[model samples]
Target: MSKEFEIVREFEVDASPEQVWEAVTAGTGGWMWPMEEPEPREGGKGPFGSTVTAWDPPHRYVNRVENVEDIAEQSANQLDYTIEPREGGKRAWVRYVHSGILVEDWDNQYDAADKHTDFYLHTLREYLTRFAGRPVAFATFEDGPEASKSAAAFTAVGRALGLADDTAEGAKVRARGPEGQAFDAVVDYRNPYFIGLRTDTALIRLFGRNHWGYPVGISVHDFAPDADGKANETAWRGWLDGVFSA
Candidate 1:
C-alpha cells in the first residue's frame, strides 16, 4: 500500500475566483492573512491560519503539522490545497488534498477535513454574504420567498400554543417553575435545535439546511407530551403524527 493517500475536497462557492482567490490566498477575509502573528509569505513555513502553511493568495491554502514526519514518512504527510478559477471568473472551485498518514491518524482524517473545509466554507460564506452588505439567514430559508414572520416568530409561536404571555414584543414563555414541573427539567426548551415546532396551529417547522449547510435529515429530539405535562413519553405521538400528516 502507498504510504500516502489521497483526500480531495471541492466546493463551488458563489463568488468570483478573484474574490475567492483573495480569501483563499490570505486576502482580506482569508483566515490567515491578518493575525497578531505574522503570516507566511507563500513559500515560508506558515505558522497560522487554516493550515500550518500560511494560506497563499487567491483561493488556495494548505495546513500541516510542524513535523511532517510526525504523521508519516518525511515526504508523505503534507497537506495541499489548490484554488482555481472556473467559468471565466464568475465562480470559483476549491480543491484540497491531504497526503501522508502515519496510519495512526487515519481515524481522524475525516474529522480534520470536516473541521477545515466545513468551517472554512461556513466562514467564507458568511464573509462574502456580509461583504455584499445584506441580511442572509432569514432570506435563504428553503429556497422560497421571504416570509414576514421568518425572522422574529418565536413569541408569535408561543401564543398559538396557548401557552405564552402576550406582549407587544411577542409571546413570552417562562421556564417551567419548580412546582409546575411535570418532568425533571434538564435544559432550556426554547431552542428549535432541540425541538421543532409548529409556527401557528398549522405549520410545523421543517429543517432543510443551515447557513453552513443544506441538511436533509437533522438529528434532534425531545420527549413527547404526557399527562405530567412534561415531555417524557409518546402519549400524544399519534395525535402529533396525525397533525403532521394532515
Candidate 2:
C-alpha cells in the first residue's frame, strides 16, 4: 500500500483579510501560478485542471486535483487555504495544507512539495505587501532540470542579484544573468525567506531554498503581462541551465 503525506504551513501577513482573500480567490491583486484565475465556485475549474471543492469568501478555499496532466493515473492531491483576521484586522493569518498520496518515491515527492510550499507562501506575502489591488500577469515555463539540481542553481542566481544579507526595502537592484539577460528593479521586500523586486514594468521575486535535500533550484516570479513572456522564459531557462551545469 502507498503511504499518505500531508504538508502544512502557517504564517501571518500585515494585510486585511479582505485584501488577502481577493488576492487568493479573484487574483485581483496577485496570483501564485502563471495561469488565468479560476472561477470562485464549488466545482469551478482551477489551475492545473483542479476543481474547487470549497469556496468561502475571505475565510477558506479548497482545491482538489483529481486529474493531472501526466501523473493523473498515479497520484491524488488537494490544497486548502484558510485565512483569518489578526492584529485587530490590520493583518491576516494564513494556514495552507497540501495533502496527497505517493504511489512511489514518497520521500522525494514529499520533500519537493514541502520546500515549494514554503516558497509559494512567502510569495503570497510578497504579493499582499507590494502589489495588492493591482492587475498582474504570469507566464511559467517548464522543462527545466529536476528539483534537486535546480535549487543550487537558484542560490547562485540570488548571489548574482546581490540578495545575500541585504534586507533593505526600496534598495536599487541590477543583475545580469547569462547571455546578457538582466533585471533592473527596486527591492520591494526582503527577508531570509524570499526577495521581491519591482521594475518599471514588472515585479520579480526570487527564492533560494533546498528542494528535496539538494540545493539545486531557484524559482523566479515575473509579474508582468507583456508579449515578451515566451522570449523571456526561453532565455531564463537557458541561463539557469547553464548556471546549474557549470
Candidate 1 residues lying further than 4 Å off, grouped into runs, are 1-6, 27-42, 48-79, 102-105, 132-246
lDDT of 2 by residue, 66-169 (tens): 65567632377888989999988999999989987777777777766676677667668877886677656554444455542443555566676656655477
Give candidate 2's error at residue 178 in angstroms.
5.3
Each candidate: what lDDT?
0.38, 0.67
lDDT of 1 at 164: 44
Q: Can you tell me which runs of candidate 2 are displaced by over 4 Å?
A: 27-31, 72-74, 145-174, 181-220, 223-227, 241-246
The TM-score of candidate 1 is 0.38
Any idea how many clashes model 1 has? 10
List RMSD in Å for every model shown. Answer: 16.3, 4.4
Instruction: State the weakest 10-residue window (summed lDDT) of model 1.
Output: 194-203
